[model samples]
Target: MNFDAFITCAVTGSGQSHKKSDKVPVTPKQIAEACIEAAKEGAAIAHIHVRDPETGAPARDVALYKEVVDRVRSSDTDVILNLTAGMGGDLILGNVESPLPLGNGTDMAGATERVAHVEELLPEICTLDCGTMNFAEADYVMTNTPGMLRAMAARIRDCGVKPEVEVFDTGHLWLCKELVDEGLILNDPVLVQLCMGIPYGAPNDPNSLMAMVNNIPKDWVFSMFTIGRMQLPYVAQAVLTGGNVRVGLEDNIWLEKGVKASNGDLVARANTILSAMNVNILTPAEVRAKLNLKKRG
Candidate 1:
């Protein structure tokens, strides 16, 4: 618990948070600027997700990803870039009348299309959702079957990029282990992210958190976070559980009650807490070294 800690600020998620809080970066330029600000505020890593410049919705276009990567790389900030490879497969169910094909606004694609940006941009880290689950209140579903995960893992391995396995529940942990066992993913200190309190997935509770943590392989390097109001409390919980912390507009939009948060404000608040607890907040370079991640080419 007294070990050095690192915080990854998920600057802008590929979600509708932009409308909820203006602080959520929309375009590539805005995202890059937020990353720089987060780095200055003490975030070791910037977890990035590109949005359609016009609509502020999630976009899997390679050009958008390239621009964001270019902007962040060109900036003076020294934050580790962690791109998202977890898009392009959103299946929203429709009524029986139009159930034959997916309803409008449903974006589904092959595994190759999902990782196109990862292969092209070659970031040091990328996220791979280990499993799928029911989404929000709508009839939407996040579908990532075992076969698809294997294919994506093989491609990520070939690219020599570290895959940050994101586990939304216990089943996902089992899937991550399967990937590791199949040799698609390398062994020892597997990178796992315990994503708590994300609609229809695991609830944000001590029992749920402990269950997921207990299931993690002892040799794996792990981090955990919750959404919305639970963000700050989950930080303390994750640290107490001996895992890293993740925070940003992606998971939450407010810094506190009635106060919306900027990406920089969230990171700054987490850093202040870390310092107060006497934990040495590691830098981006330190995180890369610890995780055995190579710099992007």
Candidate 2:
């Protein structure tokens, strides 16, 4: 088992989570506060996603991101920031009969437009989803074409911000390897997030997670996260399989049954779980050094 692990807390996600739990941070102030809280609870990094403050829906607005960044950077708490570049790829299709007219939730955009915040804010790290996949049980899809991946990966590499390539399946891992081979993902200990349990993608089963973990490059520094109920379990599984862990409202919102959790609560629980397993959870500075990450000014 890998005794040293670092936790990444995905502060808020681009999902319909706001509808389910009121604890999901929405406004920039709330998001930044959540990041700080998670860091105080022992998370080394904060994986972030901006949302419409008014409607509590996922958004790709650079201004919103800037506000969140400024707040976090200006704070006393220390945590590596990891903004999500996974937006602008939501494809909501129409009814089975009328597929031509895309649904209203579709927010597709070009590669450059997608990473606008990353280029401007220059967070310590940003995510580059490695492949396209059906998002959930609905008609929604998280579309990340190979060509798009190449472009985004190149941009993030040029920005000098570590690209946390998110791999939801085995094919995504293959594409991540290709990016590393092409020199787009420049970090030596190449970083990846095994985003398991998102429907129509990889399941949150031990066998499937091990398959993905085994395929990861022997040298790559990877983390694993699963959605809903499987989120907490992956913390143990990831550590045992020599991987880092991620938690927060983005993936799961409960500390225990009938108990809604905040970003801090989730990270603390993961911390507790790792500690019990005799795993030394690395701090943000340690994570930076391990991943060769340079924090933005």
Candidate 3:
């Protein structure tokens, strides 16, 4: 396992969990504040997902992203900003009775439409979900085909931003390799984020985690995270596998069973674990240099 590690706190994700916990930030101001708090708690990076203020639903408005970026940039914190380009692909399938068209709640778009926010508010790191899958109990499908992923990657390259290829399964990793092979992704130290223990993706077992780690290219920079109870376990697992770690309310809402956690609590917990293991948690500048990410302009 590598000694140098960095913790990334995903402040608030674009999911249907706003009502589940009041800690999840819904407005742009609230989200930026959450990032700041996480940074204060020793997180080197902050992964962000914007939502509508009133309804607390996921939104793709460029202005919303602009506000978020502006607030974080103007803040005292120096956390590396990572915006989500994983929106705009929510496809809810209808029941068997009416499966031809999309369901009534489907909110999806094409590749270019998915990344409209990233184009405008070009953060240092933006996520490109490598593949699609069923998201929890939702009737929707998170769609990201090879063609769409390639297009999104090209756009991210054009924006002079690094794309953290988010791999939810082995097949998604294969797609990431395909992107590299096709030259859509610039050949450098690739950044891959292994999303474990999702509803339909890879499980959070030791074998599954190691299988994914073993398959990753040696030169690739990777991070790992799991949801709910497995969040902290994956932190140690990720560190043990010579990779960085990601933790926040986006994946796990609770610090303990039935105890909802804030972003700061999650970062602090990860920091404690890393420190106890004699691993130095990286700072924001260290992470930026390690990932070769340009500071947000």
Cα lDDT computed for each candidate against the true fold: 0.88, 0.90, 0.88
lDDT of 1 by residue, 1-297 (tens): 736889999989877888888889999999889988999999988899889899998988899888888988887879888999889768887854666566777888898988988889899889999998987746788889898999998998899889999999889999899899999888645898899998888998999989999888777889989998999988788788889989999999999999999989999999888888888899988998889988873
lDDT tens readout by residue for model 3, 1-297:
868999999988977677889998899999999999999999998999989899998888888888988999998789898999988787777775776577876776887887888888878899999998876754668888777888889989888889999999999998889899887887567899999999899988889989899999898999999988889888888889999999998888889888899999999999999999999989999888888888885
Minimal lDDT window, size 10, model 3? 96-105
User: In candidate 3, how many Å is residue 28 off?
Assistant: 0.7
lDDT of 2 at 268: 89
> What residue runs in model 3 are displaced by over 4 Å at the alpha carbon?
none
Best by lDDT: 2
Write down the lDDT that model 1 would get.
Answer: 0.88
Cα RMSD, model 2:
1.0
TM-score of each: 0.97, 0.98, 0.97
Clashes per candidate (backbone, < 3 Å): 0, 0, 0
TM for candidate 1 is: 0.97
lDDT at 66 for candidate 3?
89
Span of 10 residues, lowest total lDDT, candidate 2:
134-143
Q: Alpha carbon lDDT of residue 127, candidate 1? A: 93
